[model samples]
Target: MAEVEIVVAHRERATLRVGEVFLKVDADRARADAEVEAMALAPVPTPRVLWRAPPVLALAALPGTALDSTASPAAWAAAGAAARALHDAPPPPWPGPSPEEIAARLDRECAWFAADDVLPADLLTRNRRLADTALRPWTPVFTHGDLQASHVFADGDAITGVLDWSEAAPGDALSDLATLTLGREERLADVLAGYDADVDTGLIHAWWSLRCLLVVRWLVEHGFDPRPEIAVLEARR
Candidate 1:
């Protein structure tokens, strides 16, 4: 019998790994459906969809280890390359969250952080100033929306797969790039090299701060550590 390992679990969703298969159970069927659809439409390599029935979606595990902070520059560049392909493809069908919606979220979270003393109001304030740069309008592209390093897999210089398409949507291309090189801003050059595009480094920095600020609260609420995000914010200082 394949031992079931809980990859991640929370109130909204849970992922379980049983040997070679990953079972994602999402409370929101629409997100799961969107994930399936996004994977199908993506030009780059995504996990093989074994089966899908409502909340339960089974996927075949990709080869190689998940990309991490310690991954080499070449691996990071490969991730950037994969992201470039995805971003260059036709945008997904969903409208996703509006810019106004994201801005509201950031404002609401900042207010909460100030009143509640969640992480550090001062840190949040400084980062918020920088974060504003990313809130501007940009040409929409096929964005992964949550291209965390952990969601990408690579074997040496080649990326074997990219995972978690639940947040796939039509959005800013730099947002994906920013998420890819989150805390490791030093690797932005390597990623841009593989991306083979001229990206504004300052704007990417803004997205980094913004993304960290927005997610820190959610991560704490979801029983996950926000230190990595906080560290990114701290790096800015």
Candidate 2:
């Protein structure tokens, strides 16, 4: 079997090469495509959508690399600037699940865990606790929900494009900030310092903790072990 050359593999979506075009598919690719189209009107580097379906999108390919731990400070700065640009863009018509709605969804997922009796009891309780406490306050902005190093692409110091729009939504920018802040604290600090206004580190930390719990639940639901790093992060809360 010939495997598709995957440019990026996300939990919910994958970017695969089909000849010269790239296909993005998952449960939310259509919405993602629309969002990206809307974002393109602003001054940001998003992949150009060529076609769309509810859970699939076709985009033009761009050259770059994922901003992993080995990425340069310039890459982080580019990502930060891109994020700020997206946040500043006019709100799109595509509606995102509200925090309260997301909380409800989490509760439903927790129920699945309870019914299956697969997840530890403490895990469920902690997930709810963090969702309630940390994610409750904050204004929502257009956020790339999974803005980690892996979703960013760089050609030298410049960010060529941002990838994985599956989780793109109107949410607390802190959520995006937290994901970007992972691993490289000093670089994260520098990125924030370069932002237009002061960012609340406490809020970013809180969102990070909450997002960690959510990631754990997602892993458990999908039958993968939550790595020690994720486990430790969730426990620290």
Candidate 3:
């Protein structure tokens, strides 16, 4: 029998790896459903669903390492191209949040962080100011809303698969690009080369600040380290 390896575990969800399959347990079935639907709709490669039982979704393990380290520039570019392909695909009909909604979220998170004292006021203030540009109107795209480096898996210079679709939705295209290159600014050129489109790098930076600021509270409350996100926020200064 294969030893069960815990991929991630928290109150709301957990994932375990056993042999070649990964079992995801989500307290919220809607998120799981969304993930499945998004994967099915996505133009890029996604993990194969082996089976499903309410609250437990079994997926075949993808065969590549996370894109955080030892990934060639070609692989990084491939990931970007994959993102572009997904964006080009028809977006889900369901509406995503508007700029007003996003601004409200930023205000709420910023206020909470300010009062909590978990983050320095200056850091919050600066990033909050930087987040302004990202609030502008954007043509929605089918976005992997949480497209971080770790969520992308690459085999050499080719992208094998992208993991975690729970947050997929129609949103700002730059948000996806920003998330992919977050904390890895050095790789921006390669990714953009693959993206092959005119993008406002400033807006990408703004999203970087916005996302990090918004996610800090959730990460802290969930008992996960928020340092990486905070680092990104600080960089905005």
Reference-based TM-score, model 2: 0.76
Model 1: per-residue lDDT, tens digit, 1-237?
999999999999999999999999998988888999999999999999998877899999999998876778998888888889998899997796777888999998888778887656677788899988888978889999899888999988899999999999999998999998897778888889889988898999999999988998899899999998878888887
Candidate 3 lands at a TM-score of 0.96
Query: Which candidate number would show the highest TM-score if scored against the true structure?
Result: 3
List candidate 3 stretches off by more than 4 Å.
none
Error of model 1, residue 98, in angstroms: 2.4
Q: Model 3 shows how many backbone clashes?
A: 0
- State the C-alpha lDDT per candidate: 0.89, 0.69, 0.90
In terms of lDDT, the poorest run of 10 residues in model 2 is: 228-237
lDDT of 2 by residue, 23-83 (tens): 8777664656665655465467777778876577788766777787777776777778887
Worst 10 residues of 3 by lDDT: 117-126
1 or 3, greater by lDDT: 3
Tens digit of per-residue lDDT, candidate 3, span 162-230: 999988888999999999999999999999999999989999999999888788888888889999988
Poorly placed runs, candidate 1 (over 4 Å): 119-121
